[model samples]
Target: MTDRDSVFLRALGDAASRLRPEVHEYVAGPPAGSRSGVGRGVFEIAGSPYRRIAGLLRIVSGPDVALDAYERDVPFEIVNRLAADGSRPRLDAERSFRFRRGPRRFVDTLQVGRIPGTLVNTPGTDGRVELLLECSVTADGNLMMQSRAARVRIGRRRIRLPKLVSVKVTVIDGWSPEHEHRTVDVSVRNPVLGTVLRYRGWFPYEYVPS
Candidate 1:
């Protein structure tokens, strides 16, 4: 696959071959003639550790950016559209979660990072956060991605977040034959609070015609 069509392909480089066939295809974006990859499923557990913290985040990041509810068996849908940012590959992802009060949505665009073999996901508001992601593959053929750095962009100025205040993430994506679906487990944490937001769920995915 061409790097312009897949940011994960460029970020993973040689390791891209290590990903299982299905997983690789998923990360490589949709195939030719397809517009995007779509998935719908229910999260066995999804929520923030503290509602007050979530509310505080909403004030800064936008209301739909953070979920104020803690609930189980929440249904959600995710769409990943692949596109080009000039010469670079970009993935625009939108997620909508079914919360008790209403739908809580999160959107992000991931692009090639400043450094090779890494990615930057800009999520939330215009200047909410830019996450630096480093990826790895597990022996069992799962994908492990971690966020070690982040920054806030305000017009022409960009401010780096200190480790103590920056958010950290651990994500694992794998194929489960027993369940016949793709599985994802994600944990979002902070230095002060452990895992503030987390979710693990399985979903079947398919590419949509362009």
Candidate 2:
């Protein structure tokens, strides 16, 4: 559907208007056949056998809400603005996430709500293990995920685990000379296991017909 005919697109346009103007530059998709750079994520799974199992299940399930948004063809600008800063990855008040990622899948943040509180996931696949996270933004505008109240789901079964795991995602946005300004750093760790996955890079992207 055209952006003008879709209420979802209209709301996204409105929300983007409220954000920092510089963000608009990133919202617009990259040109065709551009070099969407690389990003890295570090994941560690350690603690009890339960923690290990929970982490594994998380990897298998992948990102829930964020993937859904992408499948729905949500605009990149709206999702980028909501996910870029440390705010919860909410699409709107009643909706779950504020923004969506491009088709190239270069996005690092995912929005998976948890009732009154919010749950955001940043999933990374860096050749080795698939790092999955559930976190929130800090007052300092950083992405953070705590292992406390963390859980794993395999189909209908859900397994809740301890709080010994966490992830910190640091994003650095800069003019790439080639693709304006865009860069990000992500790290995930378990006190018992250390660093498991890490990536630092960027992706050049452009929005196609939805």
Tell me the lDDT of model 1 at 7.
82
Write candidate 1's Cα lDDT for 1-210 as tens digits: 333248888888888888887787678787779879899998888878686777777655554567677788989999999888788888888888897777788788888888877888887756467789998888887788899787876668778888777789888888887877898898889898778788889888999999
Give the per-residue lDDT digits (tens) of candidate 2, residues 1-210: 111111112223344343233333443222334222122221121112232354463464443311222122222221332322354222221112222332322333344444323333434332111223333333333333343344445456555544454333333333345554443344444566665433344444343332
lDDT of each: 0.81, 0.33
TM-score of each: 0.92, 0.39
lDDT of 2: 0.33
- After the best TM-score superposition of candidate 2, give how far the Cα of residue 92 lies from its true spot, in angstroms: 17
Residue 100 alpha-carbon offset, candidate 2, angstroms: 30
Pairing residues by index, what is the TM-score of model 2?
0.39
- TM-score of model 1 (CA atoms): 0.92
Residue 195 CA displacement from its true place in model 1, Å: 1.0
Q: How close to the true structure is residue 108 of candidate 2, measured as C-alpha lDDT?
A: 37
Q: CA shift at 38, candidate 1, in angstroms? A: 0.9
Winning candidate number (lDDT): 1
